[model samples]
Target: MAKMQRNTVLVVLSFFAIYFIWGSTYLWNKIAVTELPAFMLAGIRFVIAGSLIFIISKILGFSLKITKQQFKNTILAGFLFLTFGNGVVVWALKFVDSGFAALEVSAQPLVVLLMMRVFQGKKIQPMSIVGVILGITGIFLLVGQKEIIAQDGAILGMVLIFVCMLSWSYGSLFVGNADLPKNFFVNTGYQMLTSGISLLIISTLFGEQWISPIDWSIPVITSMLLLIIFGSIVTFTAFNYLLRIVSPEKVATSSYVNPIIAMILGWYFLNEDITAQSAIASVVLLTGVYFINTKKSLTIFSRFSGKRIPKDPVG
Candidate 1:
């Protein structure tokens, strides 16, 4: 009974980390990217974070060894999810508000569903089909706003972000079946290290000017530290933990919460404008996500209200 209680506490804390910390990452990334080049910022952040993860894992007695196949798979996953998927979205932050970018990326479930249909010949459930349609409508409402589209490079940024979404969606499918390091912490560290190196290579190839950390402003430095520690290490660990201890549909509730947190933070801190149309789109998009995951039990609200989730087989 004591062990079960401790596990429940850890589960709740992990859920909080993924729900809140991951949501705040958009604001941190926006702040850091403002003063640093996109690739360099992301590369440095992940490299440091990955190194720290390895150190912590070693201290905790986790093995670092993996098979050759696992190494290759990790590299591929890293490039798809981090180097291109996340890096390009950071670049788009140069042209779009943090809140806007988060809202747009909130359509990821829709993209993943479509990709599964195309690549795996998976049948889309009736409810998920409705989600896809609402998702499409939400995206149209979001990107069609004249005020947003008229911004310089806004169109290009939105296009590239969509591409990044596709990359992330594909990466999710790949990782679902890929042989990776047995230890989730070690697996995540490998992905971060490989992707960080790839991002640095891309940065060098693009000839982006690298600014020294000494010259970075206080806000930028703070943001970078927050991102590396909380955003990458803490929240990602929590995410993996939740995936092990709970239903995936419950873990995925972060998708619904993150954008709302981001939008509020962006508005409060950066004074980002929240248009009426964008609010409507957020509702529509998240509603679509709800439908997509309705086939599975989602207990976000109950959990938030201090209700215990039914136990699942731990992975």
Candidate 2:
């Protein structure tokens, strides 16, 4: 009973960490990018975070032993997660407001549904397909409320960021399918180190030099460290572990939560304008999450394959 209670507490606390802290990353990117270039900041963040994870894991006696095949898989996963997913998100912060950026990335599960159908041969349910459509519509509506639209570089950046979210979704699915290490720390450390190195190389090729003009004061350093610790290590590592403990639907709830935090932080700190449109769109998006992540609804499509899902309201 005590062990169960302890686990329940841990899971609940982890959800708070991922939903709230990861939610605030958009704002963190906004703050960091004020004077520094986006890619450079991201490259540095990952390298530092990876180093910390690696060092700590070694201290904890975690060994990252992998066969040659797994090494190849790690590289592919790293490309998807680090190169495409995070790389573009950090760049997008250079263009869009963090709140709007968070809302845009919230469309990930819809992308994942389609990707699953394509790659994993997983059948998507009809109602869930409708949910995806509604979620996408909500995203478009949310974007309609955007205060500004940068045409050239900024618009391209937004497109890339959207693609980044898709890549992350696809990468996560692939990682789940792949033969992986049993130890989370070992696997996570390997991923961070390898991927961070790739990011460093990419940033260097793109001339992402560190800014001496940018504030490197104690507070700035502290903020960046918090992002590495809370945003990267805590939220992401906890999130990876959450799948073992809870329903994916419950895990998917963070999609809605991230944007809510982003918007509230915007209002509190950056003072971005928001409206009824955002509220309505956000609610509709979350309802879509409910339909998409519910396991029974997914099983109906998989078990029956072709027959229409029964109009059982319980599902």
Candidate 3:
């Protein structure tokens, strides 16, 4: 009974962590990217976080071993989800508001649905078809705003963010069946490490100037630390834990909540403008996500496939 009660407390706290911490990451990334090159900033953040996870796993007596195929799979997942999916979004933050980026990325479930149809030939359920329609309407409302599209590079940023969405959606499908490390923590660590290394290499190839920690302003430093500790490590750990303890549908609620938190934080802290059109789009888009999530037929991955479908990781 005591163990059950303790588990309940942990579940509540974990939900809070994923909901709040993951949502705030957009603001943190925006703050950090203002002064640092995007690739270098992301590379350093993930590398340090991944290394810390490795150290902690060792201290907790978790083995870090994995087969070569798992290693290769981790690399592929990392590049798709983090190196390109997340890294490119960070770069786009320079051109778009943090809240805007969050709102745009919230359309991920829609993209995943379309991808499944195209690649897996999965039949789109009737309810999900409605979601796809609403999602498209919301995206059009959000991106078609003249005030937003009129800004220099705004269109480019939106385009790149869409591409990132594709990468992430595809990664979700791939990881569903891929043979990864059995330990979720270790699997995440490996993905981070591999992706971090790839990002640094890309940073070098792109000639992004690296800034020393000593030269970073207090805000940038604080944002980076927050991103590493809370956004990446703590929230990811909670996310995996919640997946084990609850229905993935419940765990997936973060999708509905994160953009709301992000938009509020971005508005309060960064003074980002949120127009009426954006507010309506948020309603429409999130409603679409709600429909998709609630209908079992529209679940991210079909369970009938006899493959393990992991919940989508926090952005």
Q: Using lDDT as the measure, which candidate wins?
A: 3
lDDT of 3 by residue, 60-168 (tens): 9999999999999999989898999999999999999988888888888888889888998988888888888998999999999999999999999999899999998
Question: Using Cα atoms with residue i matched to residue i, what is each candidate's TM-score against the true structure?
Answer: 0.92, 0.86, 0.95
- What value of lDDT does candidate 2 attain over all alpha carbons? 0.69
Q: Which is the winner by lDDT between candidate 1 and candidate 2? A: 1
Q: Rate the local accuracy (lDDT) of all candidates.
A: 0.81, 0.69, 0.85
Write candidate 2's Cα lDDT for 119-238 as tens digits.
768778877887787888787777665445533455766687777877786675666556655566666666667777787787788887676635576545665777788877887767
Per-residue lDDT of candidate 1, residues 255-286 (tens digit): 88888988999999999999999999999999
- Displacement of residue 280 (Cα, Å) in model 3 is 0.3
Which 10-residue window in model 1 sums to the lowest lDDT?
306-315
Model with the higher TM-score, candidate 1 or 2: 1
Q: Give the root-mean-square deviation of each candidate in angstroms.
A: 5.6, 6.1, 2.6
lDDT for residue 212 in candidate 3, whole number 0-100: 91
- What 10-residue stretch in candidate 3 is worst by lDDT? 304-313
Best by TM-score: 3
Which ten contiguous residues of candidate 2 have the minimum total lDDT? Answer: 306-315
Better of 2 and 3 by TM-score: 3
Model 3 vs. true fold: TM: 0.95
Relative to the unseen true structure, what is the Cα RMSD of model 2? Answer: 6.1
